[model samples]
Structures are given as C-alpha cells and as structure tokens.
Target: MRLEDLLPSPEPVRFVAADGTETPAPAGHVRPSDELLVEAHRRMVLGRRFDTQATALTKQGRLAVYPSSRGQEACQIAAVLALRDDDWLFPTYRDSVALVARGLDPAEVLTLLRGDWHCGYDPAAVKVAPQCTPLATQTIHAVGLAEALRRKGEDGVVLALIGDGGTSEGDFHEALNFAAVRRAPVVFFIQNNGYAISVPLAQQTAAPALAYKGVGYGVVSEQVDGNDLLAVLSVLTTAVQHARSGRGPYLVEAHTYRMEAHTNADDATRYRDEAEVTRWAAADPLARLQTYLRHRGLIDDEAVRTAEDEAEAFAAEVRTKLNADVVADPRTLFDHVFAEPTAQLVEQRAQLVAELDAGEA
Candidate 1:
C-alpha cells in the first residue's frame, strides 16, 4: 500500500456528546461490561480525590507543587481500562491519574512531589514507566521499549501518553517515524488539553488535528472527545486491538480541556479567558457521566453520596499516610543513578553524607 493509504486521516470518532447523550460505537466495537463501567467510575472518583488532596497539601506547604488532573480523569481512566494488565504504559508528569488507574498507589506517587525518589516501585513491575518530566522524551523511550518487545516476540502493546504541545517536538515525530518504520506495537495517546502550560494548541500546530501528524509517518490515527469516557474507551480499545494484531502504531488525539492551572506554580488565568473555563465546565466529564448514569437508572442520589463518601475516605487515608511517613533519606538519591556506582558518584555520595552530618541543606 502507498504511504498515504497507511496513514490515518484527520476525521474524529465520537460515542458521546457534551450533554450526557450516548452514541453507538462502530459496528465491530464491543461495549464494556457493567462491572467495568462501575470500576471506571470508581477509578475516576479516586483520581479526582487524589488530585484534590495533592492540591490542598501543596497549598499547605506539605508538598513542593502539584499538577491537578481536575478535568482529565475520564481521559486517563478510559485509556487505562482499554489496556491489559501486561501492556506497558508511558506517562507524562501530569498523568499520575493514568498511573493511578494502572494500579499505582496514591501515597507512593505523592512521594515524588515530596522531593523524594522518582517513585516507590519498579516501572517494569507494573508495566508503567516512571512519569517523565522532560515533555515528549518518553515517546522515544516507549517506542524503543515496544520495538524491543516486538523483537522478543512478546504479545503486548505500549501506550505512550503525551500532551498536545509534545506533538510539536522532534521526539514525537522521531518516535512515530521509528514506530511506523519498524511496525512496533505501540499507541501514541496525545492528550490535547487545549494548552501546553499556557500555550494553546493552535500555537503549537497549524495542522487541523494533532492526530493528523501521524499521517506524516504512516501511523494510523484517530481523534475523540477525551472527556467522554465511553468515547475515549472506544478509541483506545481500537488502538490496542490494532497494536496487538500487529498493525503497528496508532495515534489517538484525545480532545480534553484543562480546567485547572497547568501546575501549582502556573496561573492559567493569565493566558486563558474566564469564559472559556465556564464553557468547558459545562462539559465536565464527571458531571456528564453522572447525568447519563442517573438517566439510565444505574445511579441514584444514594449511590452518588456513597461514592463521594468513599472517595473522601480514600483521600483522607492517603493524606494521612503521606504526611505520617518519615522523610526518605537523601543518600538514597545516589543509589538508583547507576546499577554500579561510578567512582565519581561514590565520591558525590560521600560528599552528600558529609554535608548531611554537618547539618547543611
């Protein structure tokens, strides 16, 4: 087939509306089970609760800074639900919600914000990479890992999550090109939250959609309403199927809105208008999903109240643990840098210990 034929077009697929309406999935697509739907809702609630706690802790000076995933829980939960436990996940710094959905603990995640080690577990243990801060770099790492897995005859996919601003980066392009050329088993999940730390998506690209960029590298792609969990789940399921079936990489542009500032250190109001925030708030995923579920008689006031209570309890527990735990040793920072510490690193560790003994910062 021609390269153009192999590339994904810019058309979008949507299975839900902003007003809590449902649309049918494609004929071949399968609907998720009720159990999965309930689980998805639980995960989203937990993620939002965790985000709220983290933000409060940041404001109270318990954490360095926090990036809220306020309006993006559905995006992460849906994408994560579409994956198998064995599939790998590469997440960006702002995607701890996605990591949480993939079974990462909230207290362990808060450790990173506490200025401790990268995270509490081996990334390979849960098949989720450590959250990458240098935007878009994880794309390259994900592609390489997928390529290695493919060579080893493994039957799993790698879902690489990135921001829209990352789409403009060379690493994004390089990863897509490499994945396409090698037919690596991976999915490029672009969370286009309309802004990259105050830079709107329009400023980052002139393309009609970020997913269209995949066309340049012959990767199949699709765009969907990231706020609609059902829609995101459908698209991600398709992408996973494609990768598992040896169709190589797929690019998924999840159209979401960032309801909060980029991070605790950011002031989004300086760049975005209040009217825009108001508009997006009307389409809030959690509210819309609640409306839909209630309409379907699958949820009630008591159920919602119960969910709220459960979420609050979970958040409180995490906060208690995070605050009560003893601070990690500063010396352990040098331990994970290398499998075998270099002479220079050994010297650096000694210097750090000496400084600690001297009661210096």
Candidate 2:
C-alpha cells in the first residue's frame, strides 16, 4: 500500500469517548488481558494527576517550569508498556508520564525541570535516558544505544519518543538512517500533536506521512490512532516485538492532539482557538477509559473517588518533597565536569568562587 494512504485523516482509531464508547480492535491484534487494561487505566490517571499537580506547582512558584502532556496520555502509556525491562527508553521533555510509568520517581523526575541535575535516578539504572529537550538529539542517542546492544548480541531494544516537530530536525533523519544501516533494535515513536509548539505539521514537512519517512531508509513503519489507547497499545506491542525479534527498527506515528499550552511559558491561546480546546477536552483519554472501565464493571463511583483522593495526596506529597529537599550548591556543577579537573577548569572554578566572595552580581 502507498504510505500516503496511512497518514492521519478526520477519522482514525478511536476507543473510549468522553461520553463513553468503545471501538473494536484492528485485525490481527488480539484484545488485551483485563489486567493490562486496568493497569493502563491506572497509569493514565496517575500521569494526568502528576502533570496537573506539577503545572500547578510551577504556577504557584513551587516548581521552576513545566511542559504539560495533557491530551497525550494514550500515546505515552501505550509505548512505555510495550517495552521489556531490559529495553532502553529515550524520552523527550513531554514524556514525563512515560518516564514515570517506566518507573521513574516523580520527585526525582522533577529535579530536572527544577534546574537541577539530569534526573536523580541513573539512566542506566532504569534503562531510561534523561529527558532530552534539544529536539531530536536524543534520537541519535537512541540509535547508538540500540546499535551497541545489538552488536553485543544483547536481547533488548530502544524505544525513542519524539514529537512531530522533531521530524524537521536533521538529527531525526540522521538517526533513522544510521539505525537503518545498522539494523538497530529500536522503535521511533512519534506523537503527532499537530503543533511543534506553534508550528503545525503542514509547515514542518511535506512528506505524505511521518511514518513514510521510514521508507527512505528501509525502516518498517505503521500509523495508529494516538488518542485510541487500545490501538496505540496493540500497534506498539507489535512494533516492539518486531524490533526485539531482529526485524530492524520500526516507526510508529501516533496521530494525537495537544490540548493544552505547549508549556507553562506558552500561550497556546495565541495560536489556537477555544473551540478547539473544548473539542479536544471532550475527547480526553481518561474520560473514555473511565467510561470503559465503568461499563465493564471494573470501576465505580466509589473507586473513582478513591483514585482521585490517592492522586491528590500523591501530588501534595510531591510538592512538599520538592520544597523540602536541600537545593544542590551551585559549586557542585564543576564536580562532574571531568574525571580529573583540568588546570583551566580549576582556575575557572576559583574565579567563580572569588566572584561569589566579592558579591559581584
């Protein structure tokens, strides 16, 4: 089939609706186990709560700044769940939910956004690299990591997440090309949220579909409804299996929407309209999942209240810990600069200390 035929259109895979409706799974993809569905629901709820509380903290001066993933929960959770423990994760700034679901602690994850170190947890410890904010640079790292693991005869893959905006960067193509040549065990997960900040996909690329970009480099590819949790999960599961089983890298373009401001610093209201926000809100991921759960008798009003209470407490605790933790000294930045400090680095450090002592603003 021609790649253009798979690009997103008005009608894509949709499961739960804000008002509660179910969509059937695509052919060749079996219905997931009940346990997996429940877990997906829990993770999405937690992720949404975490993002909302973090944003609130940033607004109240408790946190530095926040980049929200309001309407992209299905895309995030589906991909993360598809990975094995040994597999690696390459995340972007908006992938906090995925990171947490992959087991990153919320308190530790916040340290990065708070202008501290990368993340308190070691990337190697959890197989998740620090959130890369420099566009598609992490795509290169993902390719490299996957290639290394493959060369060593390791049985694992790398799952790299990027926004549609990232496709415009040279690094994205370069990484894809390198992964293709090496047959790296990796999957490039692209969440097409319409806008790369304010730049829409139409302005970013003329390619028939982002997934088609894989065709140029012999990468296997697929397109899934980013808003449909079931579709996202099924597609990612197959993609991961393909990579792990040595079929080469896979590209999954999830067509989704970004319902909130790009970041706390952004004014989405400037580029988009209120009607759009209302429309997307009505198609929220959590609402549909809850509706499904309720319909299946898996959750009820009491369970909903209990989940909200737990999420609220968790958010409150995260704020308290963030405020209470000892802020790292500014001088410690120099400690990790080298194995042994260079003479020039030593001199620079002394100069900085002297300036601090002199109270030179």
Candidate 3:
C-alpha cells in the first residue's frame, strides 16, 4: 500500500467550534448525555480553579514547582473521565488535574509537586502510575502494563498521557511500536500544547501532526481540538472504547496551547508573543464550555455559582492541607525500595539517624 493510504486523515475530529457553537459529531459518534456534560463542565471548572490555586501555591513556596494545566483542563479531565475504574492511567508531571478527576485526593496528587520523597498516593490502590518526571518514560511502562494485562486475559486498558515534547523521545516511538505489535489495549493521548518548555512545535518535529507518528506504527490515530470539552470527551471516549473492546492501541493528539509558562521557574514572554497568547486565551476551554452549556440551557447563573462555590471549597481544602506542616521522616527514604533493606542501605540509614541525633545534641 502507498504511504498515503496508510495515513490517518489530516483533519482533526471536532464536535464544538472555537466560539462554543455545536458542530455535528462525526457519524457514529455517541453524543454525551446531559448529565455527563454537566459533570464534565463541573470538572473543568474545578480543574481550572485547582490549577489557579496550585500556581498561587508555587508563588508562595507551598509547592516546589507547578506546571499549570490552565488552558488544558478539558483534555486532562476528559481523558480521565473516559476511563473505567479498573483502567490504568500513566500520567506526566503536568497531569495532577487528571489524577484528581480520576477521584484521587487533590492534596495527595500534589505530593510530588510538594517536594515529597515519593508519590503522595498509592499507585496500586488508585490504578494510576506515579506522575512520571522523565519525559516519555511512562509510555514504555504503560505499554508493558497493558501488554501484561492482555497476556493474563484481563480486561484492562491503559491511558498514557504525554506532551508535544515527549513525542520526540525515543521511548515514545518504542512504546508505540510495542503496543502495535502486541495489540496492547492502550491509548496514547498526546496533549500537543505547542511547546516543550521554550521550544516551539515547529522546532520539535516536521511531522504533519503528532498523530501521524502513530500511523507509521499501524496504530489508529486521530486528532481533536483539545480546548473544546465536548470534542475532547467524544474523541477520548471513542478511543477508550476501542481499546477496551480488544482492539489494538489508539493515538489521539489533542491540539491545544499552554497559556502559562512551562512551569513556575520559566518565563513564557521570552519565547512567545503576547498576541499569540491572547488568540489562544479567546479559545479558552473553560470559557467555551461555559458558553455552550449556558446556550443549551444545561446550565444557568445558579449552576455557575454553585460550580464556582464548589471549586473554591476544593481550592481552600488543598490550600489548608498544603500549608499545614508535614513532618518528614528521614527513614522513609529507605522504605519501599526493596523487600528487605540491603546492608548498605541499613548502614546508610543508621548513619543518617546518628547525624540527626548528633545535630540535636
């Protein structure tokens, strides 16, 4: 077959316009119910608020650093909501909102960002892998876990989240190749937020779209307007269903922009123009989704206020917990590393305890 015949179409699948108008979903797309739509809206609102609060915490030194998902809430929330309880989520550091949406505690989800030793929550209990810091590494773990489930005859799917920058990682290619060859039940959701820190997409890859990379691996690939909540939800839900039904892996490249700097430590002004940021801000996922919900009479001023109130409560709770003193036990460093501590680890732990005791004396 010709290369053209093997590629996914260039057009992204979208069900909502930038102006918040309803567009027809592609044929066979199942429209979400009013309840699901409302719930999604609530989560989006809460996600944005959570991001705002977390960013503030970074400024106040409550958090070591934060990669704000300010403009990417729709993609994060929709990805998690599309998964089943038994499904696994492998997230990057920027995916705290996704974890929270998956029913993990917000404060616990931020534990890593809070400069804690280990991931705050138990991954096994929540079916979420630790928020991976090394780019694209989690993709390999995700494919391996999915393949293991398939081998064991377990009905579980894995959703692996990566950024535009991660697409350039070698692990990303390896994971896609393995998933395609093994027919692993996994979905690779790439949030193309236009930058990997100061580097822009044009400099990242010359591929027509990141989804095209998946096509080369013989994986079903598609793109969506990541800022549109309904569009993201629809596309991700379809991909999740496909994976769960014993179909091979799918790749979704969500076209979105990061409205904030890469993290608390970087200056976005150095890399991007203010007008460009303004253009994306106009297409803000939260604003567009609110407009759609209000236009359809699915939400009202009262509902908006209620959502805002709930978001504030969530922010307040996170703030209170984060501000409280957390006593760190130095011994915890040796825990969970091995079934039994090595002799070297035992000696190191004893030396650390002795140093602490000496300092106290």
Number of the top lDDT candidate: 3
Q: In order, what lDDT does every prediction score?
A: 0.84, 0.83, 0.91
lDDT of 1 by residue, 83-182 (tens): 8999999988888788876778877776677766677668878998888888899999999999999999998999999999888889999999999999
Across residues 33-52, which tens digit of lDDT does each residue of candidate 2 receive? 66787788888888889889
lDDT of 2 at 30: 55
Candidates ranked, most accurate by TM-score first = 3, 1, 2
* Runs in model 3 lying further than 4 Å from the true structure: 1-6, 351-361
Q: Can you give the lDDT of residue 189 in candidate 3?
A: 98
TM-score of each: 0.93, 0.90, 0.96
Candidate 2 ranges with C-alpha deviation above 4 Å: 1-19, 346-361
Q: How many clashes show up in model 2?
A: 0
lDDT by residue (1-361, candidate 3, tens digit) is 3466335556777777888888877665677778988999998888889999999999899999999988999999999889889999999999999998888998899989988855989899999999999999999999999999999999899999999999999999999999989999999999999999999999989998998999888898888889988878888898888888888899999999999999999999999999999999999998898898889999999999999999999999999999998998887898888889999999999999999999889
Report lDDT (Cα) of residue 144, candidate 3: 98
Question: C-alpha displacement of 113 in model 3, angstroms?
Answer: 1.2
- The positional error of residue 173 in candidate 2, measured at the CA in angstroms, is 0.5
Winner of 2 and 3 under lDDT: 3
In model 2, pairs of residues that clash are: none
Candidate 3: deviation at residue 37, Å? 0.8
Instruction: Candidate 1: give the clashing pairs.
Output: none
